[model samples]
Target: MARSRSRSFITTEKPTTYDEDQFALPNLNSNWVYYKGAWLVHIILIICVKILLSSVPGVSSETSWTLTNLSYMLGSFVMFHWVKGVPFDFNSGAYDGLTLWEQIDNGAQFTPAKKYLTALPIGLFLLSTHYTHYDAITFLVNFTFLAVVIIAKLPQLHKVRLFGINRLEVE
Candidate 1:
């Protein structure tokens, strides 16, 4: 028997999935995230941001870490979730509607890459919290960003847009 695909009540529209598109050719846009170096890039970017923020006058360690955490979190969310469509035009717009996260691994959940991607934000949040000395305000702010990043990766929220944000126009 075939399993039925379910949608959450909050899900306003179903997302178009391209499982077969992977067999035709590889998606350079999403596949790059799997590279060993790509993972390192995230860490390097985090460290760079931490340093940049730290160098600014009057920016304490706590503030620097919090800024780094927020910067990475927002960038991750926008890159993997907020933005739709592929950067390359090779696929003839086949992936025009899917975000990088959805395009990765052909929308499979809990893959090794996905797990690592999910964990990166959590780890960063922890690092920020520790560096911030567990300040209540910093913790809450970092936690909120982390929460959004984690929620965006959830299979349930795949291709979902709340309040019509980021929904592709169907003209």
Candidate 2:
């Protein structure tokens, strides 16, 4: 069978809308982002990346920090925005179509965790820009990455698939 492409501008995910679960067990997929020490671990990981990159002989401090920022940005964007569905089957596929960002906090908007995740990239961009000594080129590069990630996290864009980019083809 041929898979038809979704040429639509925005694909709404209403078909997979939320269903009340009687079990009420935690969703293992997204709950971890709000778990204790999650923030600390995130910061520690960034520090480790900075340290590791700095140890590279050819890598300057600015480059290392920029690379660190890029690494975190890329990873977080994919983890939060790009990738959908749960890795574990514990939730019985309730979260199978939602990205981690949408799955977090039961899809609430402007929650503390959401706010922190939003602020994190901006903080990294500011730090990278400052450390790069306000270099024009690096600033733009960092800003672009930050913008793309931030836009995808916006409440208005929830479950939105622009240009059907990530829509399930069979649907």
Candidate 3:
């Protein structure tokens, strides 16, 4: 009688920590540094838009408004995605020092509240843009909305939980 052989599958390697802070600002390879660089790029784009709007004379109001709103929307989208991979502790300094898995877990914990907070500003911005035809007002509203999104994601502020039964560390 031939006996069936049972194959054993076992691994003994410990999971690696996802600490990116080593590559951060001081190191220039961290996700936080990358986020800041991306933010600066967005700022430069906004400045270019402002300059173009002022220097060029025959650009239609519709065209200018479209460009401005597009910039804001693009910036917000970039921020939203960039934040997903960043390991930031709102309670700590600019650098969270937490592993990627820890940061992701923390973010997930507050994602529900964050989603609601994020949507409110976006909805208000859309409504304001739809009703306002003044170039200046539109610019102000668009800029303000973009700023709000950026501010809300800052490590110092991102951990805030709104209308939640469980309080975040920062709360």
Candidate 4:
């Protein structure tokens, strides 16, 4: 027996509105069950490592300071990429993702005041120090800001306009 192709008497329709709850992002900050414990763990670990390195004799304090500062710089760059909601382009052979200015145009809702509050002091300190010297206070301040971005900003990226829950839902 051959099956006959048939059409339904009723017409099909696309959905007009998605359920609001369907768009809720994972509350990584408050939802501790789904995510690991407080960000203070990482902070404490980093501080412990720094203290241990400083304790070792013959390890130049300057070198230790430089390495710590370099970590902040590298982390800042990586966090900038993730915060802008850009994916890593493996084939490009370069990380030429959207810059911060481009992200703003694309509806990134970062508070300008907050960003400048954290960034300006670090920028001025770097410039004033001529980028050659590393002070513990300045390094600590920069790392603290970077830590906030790491713990908060990356998670918030999951709720942005263009790149939020839609992407997660699709995935």
Best by lDDT: 2
**Local distance difference test values of all predictions, in order:** 0.79, 0.80, 0.45, 0.40
For residues 27-142, what per-residue lDDT tens digits would candidate 4 score against the true structure? 22212312344334434554565577678888666555555545654554444434332244322311122323223323234545235424533553354345445567755755
lDDT of 3: 0.45
Whose TM-score is greatest here? 2
Model 1 misplaced regions, further than 4 Å = 1-9, 12-22
Query: What lDDT tens digits, residue by residue, belong to model 2 across residues 27-103?
Result: 88888887899988878999999999999899887789878888998999889988887886787777666788988
| Of candidates 3 and 2, the better by lDDT | 2
Worst 10 residues of 1 by lDDT: 1-10
Q: Extract clashing residue pairs from model 1.
A: none
- From the highest lDDT down, the ranking of the candidates is 2, 1, 3, 4
Lowest summed-lDDT stretch of 10 residues in model 2? 14-23
Off by over 4 Å in 2: 1-4, 21-24
lDDT computed for candidate 2:
0.80
Q: What TM-score does prediction 4 earn?
A: 0.33
lDDT of 1 by residue, 1-171 (tens): 322233333544444365456568788888888776988998898889888899999988888888888889899888999888887686767777678998898788999899999998998887776656857877788888899899989989877777666666652
- Whichever of 1 and 3 has more TM-score, that candidate is 1
- In Å, residue 32's CA in model 1 sits off its true spot by 0.5
Ranking by TM-score: 2, 1, 4, 3
**Each model's TM-score, in the order given?**
0.86, 0.89, 0.32, 0.33
